[model samples]
Target: MRKKRRYIIVMATCILCFFGIIYFIVPKILFYTQMYDNRINVAIKNATDIHDLLEEAIHCIEKRQYYSAIKLYQKVVQDYPYHKKTEGAQHAIGSCYEWAGNYKKAKEAYNIFMKKYPDSKLAEICRQHVVELDNPIYRKVNDAMVDKPEQLDKIIKKCQKIVNNSSGQKKTDAMLKMGECYFLKKEYLMAIEIYQEIISNYPDYSRIREVEQMIGVCQGLLGNYGKR
Candidate 1:
């Protein structure tokens, strides 16, 4: 009787150990497999959705339906804020505003993107737009030089100061405006010199063709039309 009792106890302990291993180890492995499958499915679904939205938005933009494109891009930005497409969505929003001729809103959107992603590749493009929008003072000075020719020397001096102090597009515009001031003052030689400086030094400037034309006009005024 004592031997039978001991045998029964040993069998019970062995059965419990087997059940424990099955319960803990088997379920843990199954759980991890299920979790990985779920994650993969979710990633695939998200990727599909992102691709669809981007394609639709691009199509709308190509059709010149800027508002529709903006709406889709906004959805992309809101839904996938942490996705890589978010930055592109932000840039597209700015472009949409610009295409719609909403310059103020475009500027605001671009400024926001610049502030958030200062080191992004899009930052340089946004900076260029901002520079173009913010040069009202330069435009005003150029207009004053054209409209009020009696103050040509004073305007030229002022524009030269701006050129010396400013950089990038602002400096280029100031240099061009200085040349205009000289042209209005009938200082054709000085105007040609400034225009040549711009053509050589600021090749990337937007006014390159206009400066070339002005240089030709200055040459003509100086009786050097044959050179032109």
Candidate 2:
């Protein structure tokens, strides 16, 4: 009877140990799962907060307070790295860099945005800015307006290089700018040739009509004296 009692005691001890292990492990597993769910819910709740920050940044930009807008965007990018608003934050960084007169940094930031979010609408705007930065006449005009007309020849040469290296819309824009540079210098014939090339090669560009009109003006200036 003592042996029987000892055996029953051992069995009860084993049962308790089994229940103790389950009790400890089950609660741990449930706690972690609950914590994960809570994290997700918090992220969802804060999603709109990110959007509100972006809207406020836009308002700051419209008011010409670029530095303030940049500060807010930087916060959005850093604080919500995993949020859907990150792409817009990156694009805003690029725009802010441009406004801050850091064109090289702006271009780098834009390149990052393009690589990370190629299908984003903001990527298209960044691409356009990249093209504008590459344009010789645009840079020259900007420099001339800013009291740096000495950079004009350098800008023109850069445009020529761009024309030689690129094709399609980019090359067409380069060619058009090269023509404009020559026109600015009163080199009428060179300008006419470049403008005519645009008419022939980039006829689908939106600026084709403008190029055609410029070509006519160049011809008249070059003494072609034809109506047309």
Every candidate's lDDT: 0.72, 0.68
Question: Model 1: runs farther than 4 Å from truth?
Answer: 1-48, 135-228
> What tens digits encode model 2's per-residue C-alpha lDDT throughout 24-77?
988998897677546444444464777656655655544445566676777788
Q: Per-residue alpha-carbon lDDT of model 1 for 77-146, expressed as tens digits?
A: 8788888767867877886776565667889989998897898766777777667656786445544654
lDDT against true structure, model 2: 0.68
Clash count, predicted structure 2: 0
* Residue 136 shift from truth in candidate 1, angstroms: 6.8
Q: What TM-score would candidate 2 get against the native?
A: 0.38
For candidate 1, the lDDT comes to 0.72
Q: Can you list the residue pairs that collide in candidate 1?
A: none
* Pairs of colliding residues, candidate 2: none
